[model samples]
Target: MPGSGANKTHAVVEGGSIFIQKLNSSLWAEANEKKILLGQLISMYSELLKTIFKNKRSKHVKDIIAALEVYKTHYSDGMKKAEELLQLAKLPMNDAKIELKAIMELRTVLLEMNKEEVRRKRRSRAQNPRGRPNLSG
Candidate 1:
């Protein structure tokens, strides 16, 4: 909860923003769904990590943690980086020169994340041809 306060402030600011163009209801709904999914994933991952740590001495637990680390890097980091880049892109451009450079750098980071995520998914599927196990049940 280290950043909870900042998130609340950001939510307030973002919620109060004025839009020149009318918002698309479908896209907004999709975004909300995605946010909910991301939050659930983060919460589940955190709990899993805590449980894994309790059995860190086991080789299998260590392996699971390693895999989770890869998932964190490829998925969580990528999503957060993309979200940040989007926010930066939305800002009004006062200094085009500086803003362009920052945007380009963020774009490169986002592209790299996408490539890594694709590679990870391909490797995962290759390792388990039957696909990921059902966790919902």
Candidate 2:
């Protein structure tokens, strides 16, 4: 969760490729730290799955489980990709093109996660505006 807030902020920004490139540069500058943060996210998502499963009879339980499973898969893949990037970073003579490609791939994963977060926020807000729905109908 190290860059969680920043990721949200980037997702909210409306601009072109330059803005995205800036975000990518920031991410690459702290790639190792981001990798650790991704690992922590994976663990947190796994724990969330376990907690949801404990409530077996909740409404829309199947939907919730499915969504969480997808999120977990995304985080797991992100962690693996980040690890690969870290290893590539440690090589004696890394190819700049290859490193750039890897960094872009990792950035893609983070962007997708950011999109999901935004979608979830919108859905929640639509479901419960002002924290409650009108009872008089």
Candidate 3:
């Protein structure tokens, strides 16, 4: 009865352009956040590599750092591309496909970074059975 009418209203709003635009905006915000996070991770990895090299250098750590730098560049480029796509999506034509493509690309990059992060964590955990260093202490 009342709930059914409310559900219908919800469906109407969800199907409209305003809802789509809002969703796209949210995706854009998430992409930007991911880009910032990637930058921070790159900086941290670089610092770790520097500390490692100062004491005992390992080819594995150097390789991981190199890979992370490449991912950072890729993620940055994806963020720029997403911004351009957002501008294009706002044009009169209002093509949702462009926005969708941009979101998909960003998601792909995010997935790649997540996978690499998991791998790095696994390797670190394996190397240190005691687990990650406690920064709080």
Candidate 4:
């Protein structure tokens, strides 16, 4: 969210702006739907993690968390890296001096989000059966 999306916009412009380029209407629609599905999956995973922690159900949390991690790496991270590569390739970066201002800002945001995620998880589970500090309270 820090990049102002200007770079992506610029990259889109420079890269022939494929956002509107028709790649078989049906296929495009399918891809868009899949992206939305991935978003929903992320949300569902988050909710599941919250519920598992709230209920103190540790039996299968690791498996679900592992699946979520793989999903992000395979689906989300791959898309992001591809987008960055596409943007860099489209722009005429002289002598490989590509300005990754956008990606760096994005990385910062992701790191912050990761930290917040850990905090949230910890806070959600702070109230254990054993006498521990209850973040919720």
Best by lDDT: 3
Candidate 1 lDDT by residue in tens digits, 25-69: 344345544554454465466567768587554777677667766
**Better model by TM-score: candidate 2 vs candidate 3:** 3
Candidate 3 to truth, TM: 0.31
Which candidate leads in TM-score?
A: 3
Better of 3 and 4 by lDDT: 3
Q: Which pairs clash inside model 1? A: none
Stretches of candidate 1 exceeding 4 Å from the true structure: 1-43, 77-137
| lDDT (Cα, tens digit) per residue for candidate 4, span 31-123 | 645564464456467667877587565758867776777776657754565467578678864534444655557888899999999987786
Candidate 2 regions with alpha-carbon error over 4 angstroms: 1-43, 52-57, 82-137
Please provide TM-scores, in order, for all candidate models, with all chains considered together. Answer: 0.27, 0.27, 0.31, 0.29
Cα lDDT of candidate 3 equals 0.69
lDDT for 19 (candidate 1): 30
Per residue, candidate 2 scores C-alpha lDDT tens digits across 1-137 of: 75697876776674456333643665545665554455546566557766757866466766666665676565675667766878967875578987787787998889999999999899879877898876655
Model 3 lowest lDDT segment of ten: 19-28
Cα RMSD for candidates in order: 15.0, 18.0, 20.9, 22.7
Report model 1's TM-score to 2 decimal places. 0.27
Compared with the true structure, model 2 gives a TM-score of 0.27
